[model samples]
Target: MRLRNKPWAKELIDAHPELIQVQPEHVADQFAQKQPVRLEIGTGKGQFIFKMAQLHPEINFLALEMQHSALAVLLKAQVDAQLPNLQLVVANAENLQALFAGWHFSEIYLNFSDPWPKTRHEKRRLTYSSFLTQYQQLLVPDGVVQLKTDNRHFFEYSLISMNQFGMQFQQLSLDLHHDDTTWAAANVPTEYEDKFSAKGQPIYGVRAVFHQAKG
Candidate 1:
């Protein structure tokens, strides 16, 4: 799980000045911009976030990943693309509150996060109430959490948890590829998404808007 010695990671660390060691406490103040700020919790290989950043230059982006190798790949892409609106961080999703210092993000994207399918590992899933609580603390009023996955069980469990947490969800879809027209503007496929779809897997996705009334 540790990626400290990966060559790509080392190269990323050396290539990008914007990618610096960050603590959870410094996140909010660090990106207190007038423009909307969006975050991708697990930016794998940087394909999705990179394309998004390029497509929407006005919006600011923060990509968080604990895996050094993945972060490196993303950083390399950013460097190659010369994207100014993207920032990278190496951290766990659980530490979001500490990183943001009570700041609320405009939107949060959870793309194909680890399902942790076993019953005993349910708590570790990103959609758990505990993780939702942390996200609530850092999301602005009317903030949205967009999640996508190919796991049916995890997707169902996530819906239950979101309702339990009092979050409002809309634009739920069981088959994203079939409903591409509905989300075409904001739908950018991730590395996993492309692979799964290629092999004839159904992709599930949902959009949840955070509301404080439930909290």
Candidate 2:
């Protein structure tokens, strides 16, 4: 579901300039934590990040969301939360290489990304091999990408895709909510996660460690 443009979006973003980053240069200065940084792609309305930032203040968070309206809504929550460890980047996943060329992250998150169900549209999926390649470039050696989604087909597709790319699977839970593990207890629910889980929909998740190329 596409969000309509909010009239106050620009004003909201401009008001919290400290929380928003337009480029890579801005990120380094604003996020100076010595602990490794974690990136979350497509942070819709920001529920999971809002909680993650609070739970793990030791690790800095960089959330990417292209939609201004969604960012605007998140801005309000961010301001209210007042988490210095959290930062926002308004950009698309495809441009991550150019956006943070020399930078790398210890971890990345993809939560409830668009299924892009059509066979021809597989390239657009966040878990597609092309995006996975980009992610591999941005990740530090042994860094991992954690993903959660309610779509079964997309989950299976991502597992196969990561295997083909030589990613080492650390964890794979087909029914995340039912799993009584440490990660499940530590899991922060995204907006979609709450909705789907309330309706008894099982969440699928995977933690894949990228294969670093030999120098």
Candidate 3:
């Protein structure tokens, strides 16, 4: 989904130091007072990160997105709410390493990321092996990468990629909507999730723990 360029987005972000990071230097310092930083890649419009930060105030959240419009919306909401536990960055998942420098996260969330449904484009998937390696480097020991998606093929590919990478599957749910008593209660639905669930599409989830030593 292409978002319209918010010409004022950069200015808004610059004005809100409490909500967004204009520079990547000393990124970890933003959450110095909080424990166990958690990241949500592709935080579309920021609904999931907002709810997650609200629910888990002890864990600081860094929401990353590529689009200026999405960042603007999320940052504006963060500025208005003054959510000290939450911060955002307008960056792509591919450059996560350079963006965070040597910082690491305790958990990473991938919610409704693009499937990139093509054999040639498989490497672009968030759970692809190469990205998994990067995630492994960025995660603390026993840290987990959790994913939720409405696309079955993408979910299956993620499982295969993690398995091939020798990561342990801490949790797996093929149909998240089926078990209402569990994930449904804990899950903060993204905009895409709400739309898909309303249309009767089931969400798949996986929590894979990294075994490799943190960098």
Candidate 4:
């Protein structure tokens, strides 16, 4: 998702300190409720996370996306909606360990993440081992990581990476929209997923858990 820079984006996001977080150190305290936390990485336009927060009021949602311009659009909606359980942050993935330091979530969501298709850029993919390590550190033991994507290469790469990282697959669907599975029945569509699926493309999805610490 590319957009012309919004100069007011930062100031607008910063103004709503309770709903939009500026410091990673302050993320843990953003929510008004003490509930099980779930995180969504790369929240593009925030459709999925926002809907998730609405659907699951029992859980606190923290959305992490790197693009301030993209997040600003969603942040405005979140502020207007006044969803007490949802919080947004513009931050880099590399600093996740420090961002959520002393915090662990119940689940992490990766929705329509960039594939970083070039072989040389494999490390940049969200499912790369380094990112998995961060997810492991930020999730409770055996916590689930759910991923949904429209890219076959990314879906395949993520499955292999998660397997190599000692994550046990609990559920997987090669074609989430068409598959007749319980997980697919409750699927949420990100804009990217909806656009691709509308063109008859299959959406891939997986739910996996870190069975044990590896290294």
Q: Each model's TM-score, in the order given?
A: 0.89, 0.95, 0.92, 0.94
> What is candidate 4's lDDT per residue for 1-215, written digit by digit as tens?
67689998989987988788766677667778798999998997898898999999999998888899999989989978998899898887776888888888999999988889999998899999999999989998878999998889889989999999989999999899988888888887888888999999999899999987469
Each candidate's lDDT (Cα)? 0.80, 0.88, 0.84, 0.88
Q: For model 3, what is the C-alpha lDDT against the true structure? A: 0.84
Q: Write one digit per residue (lDDT tens) for candidate 3, span 1-215.
A: 77888898888977876567755574566664758898899987998899888898889898988888878998888877887778787777786777777777999999999999999999899988888888888899889899999999999999999999999998788778776656556878899988999999999998889776568
Error of 2 at 75 (Å): 1.0
Cα lDDT of model 2 by residue, 1-215, tens digit: 56998999888888877888656567767765767899999998999888898889899998899888887788888888778889998877777888888778999999999999999999999989889989998999899999999999999999999999999999889889889988897889999999999999999999999776798
Stretch of 10 with least lDDT, candidate 3:
23-32
Which regions of candidate 3 are displaced past 4 Å?
A: 212-215
Q: Top model by TM-score, which number? A: 2
Write down the RMSD of candidate 4 (Cα, Å).
1.9
For all candidates, the clash counts are 5, 0, 0, 0
Order the candidates by TM-score, highest first: 2, 4, 3, 1
In terms of TM-score, which candidate is stronger, 1 or 4?
A: 4
Question: What does candidate 1's lDDT look like per residue over 1-215, in tens digits?
Answer: 24345665766576655443445444444433557888899887778888888898888888888887878888877667766677787777776676666556888999999999889998889999998998887788888899999999999999999998888887798988887556845589999999999999989988998765654
**Against the hidden true structure, what lDDT does model 2 obtain?**
0.88
